[model samples]
Target: MKWLHQILFLLLLASAAASCKKFLNVEPADRTGSNSFWKTRQDVEAAVINCYGFLFQKFNDFNSPVIPAVGDMRCGGIGGSIASGQLGQGFYTLSQNDLSNTTNLGVPERYHLNDIDDWGPYFESIANCNITLAEIEKMTTLTDTEKKQYITEVKFVRAFTYFYICRLYGDVPFYTQPYDKTPRPRTSFITIFNTLIAELDAVKDDLPWTATNPSDLGVRACRGSVYTLIAQMNMWLAGFDKANQSKYWKDAAEKCVAVKNSGAFELLPIEETKRIFKGKTKESIFEFELNRNYGNTSLYVNLGQWMTHSPIVDYGGNSDLYFVRPLMERIYPPNLPDKRRDTWFYLPYSNNQTFMFLKQINVADPTGYWSFEDNLMVFRYADVLLLGAEALANLGSNNTEAISMLNTVRTRAGTPLFTAGAEDLKDAVFWERQKELIGEGHRWYDFVRTGRVTDPNQIITPMTQDQFDRGAWTWPIDAKARQNNPEIVLNLYWIR
Candidate 1:
């Protein structure tokens, strides 16, 4: 139970921590904690699992590890009622682009990283990874093969941590050594990204295709997940790495090829979209597993019931906040009747025929008692294919091939095909991604990576192309992230 104790101690430390920046600087519970630990494979396994747990396992808290609200809430796909006087001001400020008034200070009600809700947990998870990697090598209970697998897996997690952090806050404090008490300087976004991609590339060969163990399927990194991340990391850079945009786009296209041919995953048909997040699907490349009988502290799985409710419906959904009717109609076009339109949501004729997310509902447990049992998808084949389509179109890899990939997802949805120039094909793919990945927590990053957010859209924040190009699209490094580390430099343009 030492690992459980470690888990408790880390959670308590995270909750008790004061500022976002300082939140990441986690210290061990006892002087002997690390030295006495990492002596066996179980120790290493437990440690790595805790890294995943602390983020994915959480209930109602401002800092819950479901994808940060600032990422999507600001971009669109939701309509929130004002929670309290000034409590929900930040979200409105973000949504309405009320840039002149800068008087908000919490995390959930206010979707800014300038608050600690997101920054702390991400860094803490990274800290867990640092500790696991630093000591797993010292264990004598495992074979050389085990050592190689464990190290490679944790490195993927670490790189993903940095990658996730960079997408939200731009640049952050980078650390590789765990339990190092020194206050490290915050690294720049560019350097952090370059380092992350380089690290993933270096560890690529070492990580396995899938867990050789039967219990680890779809959850662990396979060459599929590794290359998919490479494709995604490069895509993130394509928009921001101005000087090398072409090179990065090409890299994303080439990297995704391995996942495509790995024979490990396939796109699920629209009829099978219901099975996409059910855990252990051929469609899921990486996901966090949960079972209703067991507690994982994940509250996100309850979203489907909440996002679609009204007095007329019996599923207990919170219908007030949901896909704006006009926008849903605009993007999906009820006339098109795409499978995602027909299947992912329901039109409650009783509630003026409003749209509700029906994707995660367990019909057998209509009251939503088993809602938490669903898996949280991190990466899947649909996303990977879209990544390939986007990158290939951008770099001129082959418009014909890009269209084919784009059409694959379309074929599943029974939507139209792409027959346009490369640039047009790129736009077509972005539009497809928006429709397909909605509510899965990917839109905001897509907006940032592509540098465009329109009003009368889910992302009501009216940002100019200039503002986005200058990194104004990202959140501020809040007081917590800077409180203890004077070494931290703020992204000044974000300051009101």
Candidate 2:
């Protein structure tokens, strides 16, 4: 039960120490109770798992569905209400980029929409990662190799957490040392991304190309995940730093190419939707696990709760949400022969009442409990392939390689290969990602990183350059964020 004790300790530490004073208000490292727990390999493993657990708790907070709310729904594509017309007001405001509305109108307290504004959970998780990284180096039980791997694993978790928060909040206070509590101002996300790129590049080779254990596949950090994260960070950096855009694009393309050539991952047939979405598979690069049999399942965190109706989930009559018709048609024109359209949806072009998305329909108890049975796919092979295609296209050469990567995903999805038809290669790659990765909490970030957030044709809620320059794309940091840290600041646009 030592692992259980370690898990409990981490959970209690995260909860008890949650604050905004230099990201967390923890006891001095010298006096912390966890100092005694990091003495064995099991303890290290437990801490690593706790790192991921903290993230899971953050994403699965109450009924928030934080990922999709911030990543997908905000793009202004959803058209229907969950039930009462009042319940949709907060979501509607969110979709319109109105981040100041904490009341959420008719949204009940149980739903916890405002949790999206809070960055404390992420910092708490990052704190755990920092603690584990500092403590692991002193342990004598692990060999240098074992210690290196464990250190790299914790680093990945920390870097991944930072990358995620950077995407959401833009600039954030960056810290790597253990239990450093000095109040620090937000660091340029560019600087953080650059540091992460170098840090990950140095340690990525230490991880195996793939997890040898089936259970750990996609659920644990691997070389594929590390490369994918680096590739993504490069693309994001490229978006904000225009002067070195070409260099970042090339780096992204190269990292993605490494993932492709590794032979450790491949796109599962689009028809194998359940196997792919159910978690550990050849297609998944990284995902968070949720198995109902283990009494670990979430109703609101997964998209199924909002996108499915009666047969899929006994939710009375209609689904709680539906993709806008224009957006649906734009991505999947009726004339298109993409299997994703047929395989992932019912009534693809239909009205809101009956248009149900089936991409994540693994219901644990469809007729009764109605809990979702799909892992939160943070990264997958197809996503990497598409990102590679986008990066290659941005570099303006290697057009053939770009098209090949783009078409590989298309071929698997039973869609026509790209031939540089009327659609530009870059646009084709972008639309392919929108089509293939729809409903998986990616669309909004895709818009922001690609400069499509200001393009009316690309997104429903487009932002003007002036607004975007003022941080219109970021969520409002909760007032609690500045409670103890005087150096902390909120997003300017949200305040205006």
Candidate 3:
């Protein structure tokens, strides 16, 4: 009954009018008349829920696994090859950074991920947040405290949406007002991030440190989530904005330290891998929910679809992909004692189909195709800890604190503690991130922001300096974007 109610609400949201003319081609409100809506608490709550629902649809687009294709495959996690069918072919195209030719890539069903180029989904989510923020003020039914909290939560969603799309497209039109039809050009991503950082800082404390209600735990925005977002944005700026790298690194480290000291999160034991990935545990800072029984299941959204097989998947086939053996060993050497190597992989160094990534293997029906039960983890505490370590290492003087943060995650993974000097600390943190956050979809972006995508020592598919400068890292903007707005410029790298 609860699931049915949720579905009904989502259907209502889907009924909002869509346009092909404007920058964001959708109405912000649900099907209900905006003039009469937001008069009651339930209406406000429903709109808030719709904001999250829009995000879920954006990430869980059934046509293609957008997140992994955008985030992980480009990192060469599939060893730049795969034995599986067309799916592997698709991932191979992504691995080689051959994104502009996705349409021509033979396996049209699996390889043509034009949706990744479309900014509509992200804008739809942003529009919802914008309207909610605009009209929530008119709600006399809710108290000031409640209004403040909801505003901050919606702001978090909007900020996160801008951050995500900016990373993908490099620069995007910034919008805040509801039902904004004005055509606008892409703003600098650095300026947008800086604006968002301050806006988040202003409203962060309004949200609770964590959700007290069990249902809201990781799905709702919290202070910890806000802090982590700020830290991540700062770390990203640290790499690209070299003039102020030290300030960005320091800010990132401080924000991460705040999250750690908040005592609201802790890393789960290495043995509780299932619990950790199942999501909404103490480890999760923020995640989008997906329950098998609740009629929410995403095959393309989970790594289990491509990484698990046989007894684990009840499919009489081998894994669709495996990490490159050299990269795997580079992160987890045979001589090293890493519980992640043992617990997360069947054969850490296997180049064949027997190599299975067990981190996301939680399936409800081994024999059925739609059984992936793990929620889409957007941020977890361990990822924040590692980002903190990376930021501190970049600061040059915080080597000792950086090692302390790195060791916290390592100690949980039963890996050897990092006892290295400042010179080696940054790569150590980077490798730890590769090992800790693999398949959860942070790999490719990490390489780009860290400026390690061109470092042959770090990346398997290093882009050249000229390629990097020419926007090889960004996804191509869909031609549809320029339909209504001549100001909309597509990523020229993909124009050929």
Candidate 4:
């Protein structure tokens, strides 16, 4: 069956290639046997779906090594340790922290960084979209309206790709067109951001509120996701680029309100919300859908179970790591109710039993292995609300309204209301986000966005020069990528 599928895919590629000259005088690596593959409305729809598949492929579990290597989540198991302090030394080594280079500690342990060269996968996905869009533009089979909608969807995905790279690497070699010429010069952070914002805003009105067809299942880009990205990008711009701080903050606040008023989404109830990480909720705005039967391949691994396990259970069953630090657990206010506390951590007593699993793995089978249905949420309605509240507080003159918006999140979590001053209210919002979004990979970005890593009270621990040296904020460019393209500059913030 796999071989049959491969043959069919090759035939489709061949068909696509045969028609490439009709659309653009360029040849794709794989040829489609004939032009019939993308000559109909359904054909164009399938092409858009192929673009989405590329998006998922670029970031799926096969690429899981990059998450811990780049993101701020903790790493290590019961007896296994991350020599430089956090789990995975890719970021740490780039940051130039002092760790034993003698053993597989610092640079030597980072074998994957050497292997996965460049942002090729991400760019390849973008190129796929560009090629598809170019084909669709010349496709007369699809109506004008159909072409407009499909083009909007493709542009949204492309913008998201650039946004993802920009957030991670800062100034990257930005490209929207197919790489036919020598690589274009790297765009500055400011120009890249402006371009992203323009692209998103231009297509914002063209996207549908929701996908109307099953074929559009994970294919079409919706207003909610684009607005969410806009809010995030605006927030980042406000923080990192001070000259444009006010403008982007205002833009973020408006985008947040747009999502708030869209009426297409709502927060799941507390119980259902807890099941969200497991991928059971309707509130997910955008999630990477994983299916075990989609070849029984492990889509992505959950670090939560591995991160919080105690030594007793670490060596056995599905558990390998345990929570070594109290940073996440301590972020919640001491008096916030049990629901909030229990949601974030396995209570000490709960983990006291030798045979018990210390943390919750969203989907565990009867025998206790991690289930494959667990969906990793990239954006959810709850996150949108929190972001809205933060944006409002940052740019608007409504402290009371901000508090009310925040209390909505707290009330849903069954926690007490926050009555702190404006500054404290900001802290309240920050802490709430940390607690609510823990383990979902937002904490480190929050710290960096606010420039609060060094704040004594803001972070769970003081930001050590060692931590900074370890590239906690900036991800290391893959070593081989730099070697392949000498123009690729390592992020100086992370480099020693």
Candidate 5:
């Protein structure tokens, strides 16, 4: 079955002639080539949906080891033990001098560098966007207004995919064109930021504030979603350039304000925010929707029992695959009247059993077995508010406004509001982000952006280059990709 899936995927990729084929006709019998796929509006739309299919494919399983490999979280199930220690040593053990190739041995985890096969999913999606854009440029079936909207949607998705890659690997090849004969070099951080900003600005006026129809599922990019991406990119850029930090922060702040002003989203009430782990709230701006009926079972087995279950589940017995780090647990506000902790984590009892399992992912099979649902949220309104606060505070314009934004999130979390002035407000916001976004794979990036790894209170311990060399801050490029494309550069930060 796995081989058949691979063969089908290859067939899908090999026939570039049918790249723009309509989703409604995406059956094996209708397996036309990519060249014939983008001639119609329906074809163009299907291409875009195919691009998004990568999100489902890559993140299909929790134990699939994509985000957890790079983030603060560690895995410790029967198969998790090998991967668990690597994340700890990579992120927590500071300094580049102490790590060696031998350090990562015995780890069963697939490093991003080692998993070149995964790269195609991202690039393949980008290819779909490129093909759609080309077809749209020559399209006469749609009105000018419709063309603008379609073009903007494709551009937003293209920018989004590239930006996602940038966050993981500081520099990646920027492929705007569908076909490039010459080898494209890795873009600089500044160039990537400028390009992303240009794309977002160009498309902002074209996208709708929200999708009103069911046919538009994943069709139109929302105003809040683009703003969130823009805000996040700006905040990231600010970290690399301190002298002009305010510009980036202000950019983030403005986009965040746009999201807030739209009133399309709001922080889930304290009780509801606690229910986030259970996947029951409307606070999510965008999440990868998964259903068992869709024939995608990767989420059920990969992230379901492995990440959320303790010894209680048959498949996850005696494994702490999804256990929270001791350092993270310590940072939770003590005596805070919040239910997020109770809802998000499974506090262990005297017999080492969990007191409560996360309810959002709770799924029951017909045979009386249970597992978690695979839907993982990539962006949420709660994150947007915090990003806005951080951007405002970093800009040095409105510390008061930043505090207000931060306070709104805190109040929703049932925690006390922040009272500190500008300097202390930064720490307060930082800690707040740490607490609010834990276990969602944001910590390492947070450390990198804020230079917090050196701060004792932030990381469990400072990491070394020796650790970095073992696929730490930057994920290693797949060795096969380097073999296939010699132009791709390995991360220099890890090179001793």
Candidate 6:
């Protein structure tokens, strides 16, 4: 499966370049669309494969915390390599609680990730999805089921990408057909959410519970994958919309139930964490598939390479990023014996100031440094259970069901079970997620949704409920992106 991933990665760039057509009004630059060319099933698959490249560019092209910046680091519990030299200061500054003045972070010698907009990559991905959806319907060679499957898969990925955009940017460019619209104002979040839920409902059953091959586990959309995302979206909507908490909470819980009934996933025990992050397991619902050697190009494991520099077997090297030891030790649920603390990180220092995350440390190269085979987990059963717990808590008191969900996730991780009431149970669920999904990129959103995002250092100020409500939690659109599209305006709070 990892080897198949290598093939998929190669297709992402090579086949996509030759097959994908003009999209998003960029002068049809790389488009090579023709009826005869796109006549086969391979053409449609190639187009879908092309969409993955944009996401890979954001993560593997460089060691950008593009994923973490908007997800984990902003949660204010981050600290970076205090190594002899400042190898990764950009991440350090971001973790230290400053994303506004990235100049202060100092440009790295290599992998200079410009101010956090990186919107172009996400939009480019969206455009590809749009192109695939628009053209795949017209093909006469495929059966109705194949046609529906292709359309639903593309639509699901687009919705998934847009879901992330809306969370970080609040509003964004939304389109179904590529090159059909002009540069427009950002679409409202409510409109996008309503559209996504409807689209997911229409096609959720159309997807299989699992793919025939191991490589397609999360890389390709399945019934479990689609429902999990649908469930996750409703959970966010409950937090963002606020007024219809009961509606969204119910929707979220129902979707989670759909995934559970599918019987496609399970909670892997702590001792088997290698299978969890190596991905394509009973525990994994969706993961970003990547391999060490994808031919020709060196494409090393970016996550492990950037995070650490330690030369330990099944671990990382040049360990650059870490959690502030004392605060995390304080917050990681005392006396609970959470095994993740050991599997996910190591305390090799006497001062105990840093703890390196070891989830992606299994593979290594000839030099004995961590290699690129580890698959990044996006959604797993544990996440679903925790979200279910969170949604159940929102339903009100006397929710034995919700408390059981919390206990299920906790017990698997070798942590204490929840014996508390509804309110306390909700708080336990929230903190449990913080420990469980720490570096996998869900913390910041969880913090913002629960109104618990604050400066653990006390130096960086917290956004008030008023500011959070006003859509002020989003990142400023980078200047370069604004220069490219005149219709794109700035997030007002960031305007000087």
The C-alpha TM-scores of every prediction are 0.82, 0.92, 0.92, 0.79, 0.81, 0.86
lDDT value, residue 435 of candidate 6: 76
Each model's lDDT comes to 0.64, 0.81, 0.79, 0.58, 0.57, 0.66
Give the CA lDDT, 0 to 100, for residue 369 in model 3.
60
Please provide the root mean square deviation of candidate 1 (C-alpha atoms, Å): 6.0
lDDT of 2 by residue, 1-496 (tens): 1122244345544443322211111222331465556677766775666677677778876746777788888898777764665236777777787776655534567778777788977887777787778778888999998998888888998999999999999899887876667677999999999999999999999999989999789988998999999999999999999999999999999999999999999888888998899989999999988777655567777665678888778877777778878888999988979899998988878767678888888888787757886888899899999999999999988999999999899899887888976679999999999998888888899999988999997889999988889898887788778876879988877774
- Order of candidates by TM-score, top first? 2, 3, 6, 1, 5, 4
Residue lDDT tens for model 6, 275-373 = 777777888887666554442112233333345544443344445555665556655644547777767667723123245566665553535333445
**Cα miss at 424, model 4 (Å)?**
1.5
**Worst lDDT 10-window in candidate 6:** 20-29
Among residues 3 or more apart in sequence or in different chains, the pairs in candidate 1 whose N, CA or C atoms overlap within 3 Å are 19-480, 20-480, 21-480, 21-481, 75-459, 76-458, 114-478, 209-222, 305-317, 306-318
Which prediction has more favorable lDDT, 2 or 6?
2
What is the lDDT, from 0 to 100, of the residue 445 in candidate 2?
91
TM-score of 6: 0.86
Going through the candidates in order, what is the number of backbone clashes in each? 10, 0, 0, 16, 32, 10
Off by over 4 Å in 5: 1-29, 34-36, 61-63, 74-105, 108-118, 214-220, 273-282, 299-307, 310-319, 322-325, 348-360, 364-371, 421-423, 464-472, 493-496
Q: Quote the lDDT for 28 in model 6.
A: 21
Which TM-score value belongs to model 4?
Answer: 0.79
Give me the runs in candidate 3 sitting further than 4 Å from their true place: 1-31, 77-84, 108-112
Residue ranges of candidate 6 with Cα displaced over 4 Å: 1-14, 17-33, 81-83, 87-89, 107-109, 295-309, 313-318, 348-354, 366-370, 454-461, 469-472
Model 3, span 191-232: residue lDDT tens: 999999999989989988899987777889999999999999
lDDT of 2 at 172: 93
Output the TM-score of candidate 3.
0.92
